[model samples]
Target: MNAGNTFEVEVRGIRREAETVRSFELWPLGAESAESAESGEAYELPPFEPGAHLDVHVPGDLVRQYSLTNPHERHRYVIGVNRDPASRGGSIRMHDAVTVGSRLTVSAPRNHFPLNEAAVHSVLVAGGIGITPLLAMVRRLCELGRSWDLYYCARTESRAAFLRELRELADTCPDGALHCVFDGVPGTAPLDIRAVLAKHGAQADFYCCGPTPLMDAFTAALADVPPERVHLEYFKAPEISTPANSQAFTVTLARQQKSFVIEPDRSILHVLQEHGVAVMCSCREGVCGTCETAVLAGEPDHRDRVLSPEERAANRTMMICVSRCKGDALTLDI
Candidate 1:
């Protein structure tokens, strides 16, 4: 609940989409009535593109980001949540405490995984709850009459969240395709990432969001593909290791006219917070792009999963939470 900007929404509906997954429909506080939505009345919620997510402020001061699954043109936002065995207070609270008509604060929609609408073709690969964001992309692509393919993977058929909706969508699109892979079923092997990429050829832009192992395999299989054509979103940050010979660096805040020494053991975020510098951050592991800062002058040793490889090479910005300066001195537009 510590975000800089947020608005209130009331839960209008909650439906169990799968065995362990539930879809929540949220509408702005004043326009929460079902009649308004049905009547085609104007509801003034902020517009969002596909692959956008909202930071939902749940009870107990916990904030979690969930991708929007509904069509981008809709007035309300829909998000799917899976009950994880490893409860982190957010998912458990959403399942046990939140009910219809509940009021919650959520950040405005922000997108880190954007669809390349101009690409010749789009290929979407999703696993489990990762289907949330890609579903929006599929809806948008259908609206635009674009060619696309979706490969939805899950542990079992019962675990797939929006299978029926996806099938209906595929049936309507003459050029779109949908493939479901349930690898955990008996006698079924995991989807071969290499074989899938080989079929798409050179014109397709690939998008993937899934568990760590699935994403890792997809990334490795597409190693030769141009960075611009490969888009990925991570649910959690991967393990990051610092170099053994890492050295301390100095950061100069341009606006504040201040300089601080960033120790090798401590992150730049921690040092800035200790000095009373206000920087909003969440998911300190670098999966969320909350602490992204402009780099006036410095080559950042990018360790964040949020940024693409092309962006890292540009060195125009850096995530303060886990990334560090490549050299001894750096300049930032604090």
Candidate 2:
């Protein structure tokens, strides 16, 4: 809150969370100075909900999104990143290039996957690096006195993140429980995803974030469940769509009272920002919601993974970063 959307943050500490994952403790410079003014310690971070994430700009001009792991803290942020061999230089940079004194630029917290306060029972399922968001959700559930259950799946104990915190939650939870299911551990039973999805009651909501295979399997297994009862978080864009099938279109910025042609090669976000439009955007691939603009008029081509099927059909808003115009001319509230 003390800095702009993108601000400089120093890596205060670093600890190896797993064989491949490392946790980074970042402190906002201004916030740290303000906190040290009185008690000499910055705590927590600007208020963020359970499933919030920050867009971190790493070396080599690569930007990656990582979820916040601590829901109880407000002044500082803790993010766990796994050294991905296939990374486009982001995860590898975090693991190998960054150190305690390294400084990085990060976007403010934003939540695409949020918690449902009305649910009496919450079923939190996480896999591998996907445990970041769900870890915060568990802390939030404990703080709110809500009943919940966690199905944490990992290949082995050495590859899992937040083991200590999970153990503490398992011991302290009143009505909920923790189920640690590992596949690499000898003589340990594998996690049954179908059984976990089937056991939850009607009032219980299912939330999961993990590898694509795990998420796809969960989607297929929970197909019979009500659509409203199931939720998911995706770091990767599901699919990219364009207006190529249709003719060229025009975009009218309602507030600016300006119009521009949307060509085949150029995207709406590109054209808008080029025209000096002050629209905030991150994850140019359209996974993050920084460039979500209101749809006051005309239909839009919904291609981003952030919006649900119902939201896309409603034509209320769209993520302009990757989405396009479907009609000849589209009007926006921008």
Top candidate when judged by lDDT against the true structure:
1
CA-only RMSD, every prediction:
2.6, 3.2
Clashing pairs in 1: none
The digit string of per-residue lDDT tens for model 2 on 1-334 reads 4534687788988998888999998886655543562343443356688898988889778778899988756556889999999866789989889998888988878887888867979998898999999998988888888989999989998898898888898789887689888988888876677888768856789998988777877888888888778888876765535444855689998988999998878888998889888887767777777788899888888878688778899999999887777778888997
Give candidate 2's whole-model lDDT. 0.82
Estimate the TM-score for candidate 1.
Answer: 0.92
RMSD of 1: 2.6
Worst 10 residues of 1 by lDDT: 35-44
lDDT, residue 108, model 2: 76
- Span of ten consecutive residues with least summed lDDT in model 2: 37-46
State the lDDT at 164 in candidate 1: 91
Q: What is candidate 1's lDDT per residue for 1-334, written digit by digit as tens?
A: 1224787888989999998999999887667465675455456466688888888898888888899987554458899999887957788889888999899988878788998889899999999999999999999999899999999999999999999999998999987999999998998888888998999957899999999999999999999998889999999986657888678999999999999999999999999999999987777878878788999997888889888777888998899999988899889999
Candidate 1 regions with alpha-carbon error over 4 angstroms = 1-4, 32-43
State how far residue 40 of model 1 sits from its true place (Å): 11
